[model samples]
Target chain A: MHDLDVLGVIFILGLTCYAMRAGGYVLAASMRDDGIAARFLRLAPGNLFIAFIVGGCLSGGLAGLVGTMVALVTMAVTAREWVALSAGFGAAIATSAIAP
Target chain B: MTAAGFRRGLVAALPFLLSNGAAGLVMGLTYKGLGLGASHAILFSLLVYSATAQAITLSMWASPLPVAAMVVACIATNSRYLLMGAHLRQLFGGLAPRKILLSLFLLADASWLMTSSDADRNGPDAGYLLGSSIPMAIGWVGGTALAYAAPLATNGPLKLAAALLPTMFIATLLPSQWKNAASPWPWLISAVVALLVSHFVDPSWSMLIGGGCGTLVSMMERTDA
Candidate 1:
């Protein structure tokens, strides 16, 4: 592909992504705040987050599982994100080293 | 746009400088391996600005570059943003549209999650949203450029650890998302469904399908209550 073609593809993909990012917000302007749709929006974030973690763990395998557990426990006990992330990183490395 | 809020958000997001940079480095290497020029690689990161979307595009990359398929895959992988944007509208609906839309350009998963948590505690501040988003963008774009300028030979374990950063970041935020007794059931449902979906279908769709199912269960439980 020519440089111009690559640039075009990137530009189009970028626009597509931005459209998705903005589409819901624009569409939600018509939704009544008290409606079921609004309620679903309110309730979706946590579940979405949990699903993300599960998907991540599944892809990462035992190392990912152990790392996430360590991170969750560290977050619970210390309530510090940096600390938990650090602990999780270390645990993943250790687990990866030991798993195979 | 409050200066104080922006500063707090910027400081809070400093940790991602490392996490995002590491991941971005890996992405940078991948692009380089694909034979993309430094400028093209950096532009891809800046424009697409999504690890998932970019990864998907890279998988489908070819001489002709299937433009239609790439666009479809990008939308599918990033459909979560639609839900996130709707939620943000609920939080900052009254804000000026121009400001919100401009800020949306820098929107990212980590920044959105952090901003939502911040809003729950400090109320909606678009400044903070923008501030938090800037570092993540920098880490990603800058890291991609750096990788092209200076390719780093990464080992297996180190790369694995870097890859886990986003997951770890999400895990840390899990505590704040815990609402009450009702939270567990939905969360468990989301996890199990996500695992099942990832196994059977595409892993990419797992989050949306699992999360959507879990949210439906929560809504039903709420109606019953």
Candidate 2:
């Protein structure tokens, strides 16, 4: 494809992304704060985050699993993100080296 | 819009410079391998600004690009943002809409998680949200440009480790999301459902489906109780 066509495609995709990012906020603005929709929104983040972790772990395999566990434990213990992330990265790299 | 919150957020997000930069470097290498020029690759990273969307779209890239299908795939993969945005409204409802909307441009999963956790403790600070998001954007866009220019030959283990960063970052937030006895049930359900959905359907849809199902169960449990 030509450079211009690629740019056009990227632009369109960008618009689509921004729309999704903004769409729910705009729609939610009109809803009653105490409604069921609000309840669902309140309950959604944790579930969504859990699902993300599961999907990520499954795709990432054992190394991913171990790394995430280490990260979670580190966070739980230290409450430091940088420490957890560094530890997790180290664990994942070590696991990958051993297994791969 | 407190400068203090913004400064704290920026400092807190400094770690993403390493995590996001590593992941973005891998993406840049992939884009280069796909024959994309530096300008195009950088633009894609800037405009799309989503690792999941860009990764999925890259899998579908071909000559006479499948524009319609790509758009559909992008929507499907990014649908989580809709839920996130809705929840953001609940958190930052009192903030100026224009400011919120502009800040949403740089919103990312890690930054969103960080902002949500912060809000739970410090109340909603739009400045923190915007502040944290900036470094993530920089790490991603700058890393792409840097990788394109350098094209470093990264090894397998190093790349795998880098790829795990986002997930690891999210994993760190899991503790804060826990509410009480009921939290574990929904989280377990979400994990099981996500695993099944990822196995059966497209992996991209797993989070929305699994998370939605879990949330429904939580609501039903609440009603029953």
- For model 1 chain A, the run of ten residues with the poorest summed lDDT: A33-42
Estimate, for each residue in B109-160, the C-alpha lDDT of model 2 and write its tens digit: 8888999998998988888888899899999998888877784654565566
lDDT of 2 by residue, A6-83 (tens): 999999999998887887778876766566765665566567668878877877889999999999999999988668
lDDT, candidates in the order shown: 0.78, 0.78
Name the best candidate (by DockQ). 1
Interface RMSD of each: 5.1, 5.1
User: Can you give the DockQ of every candidate in the order shown?
Assistant: 0.48, 0.47
The DockQ-based CAPRI class assigned to model 2 is acceptable
Question: How many steric overlaps are in each model, in order?
Answer: 0, 0
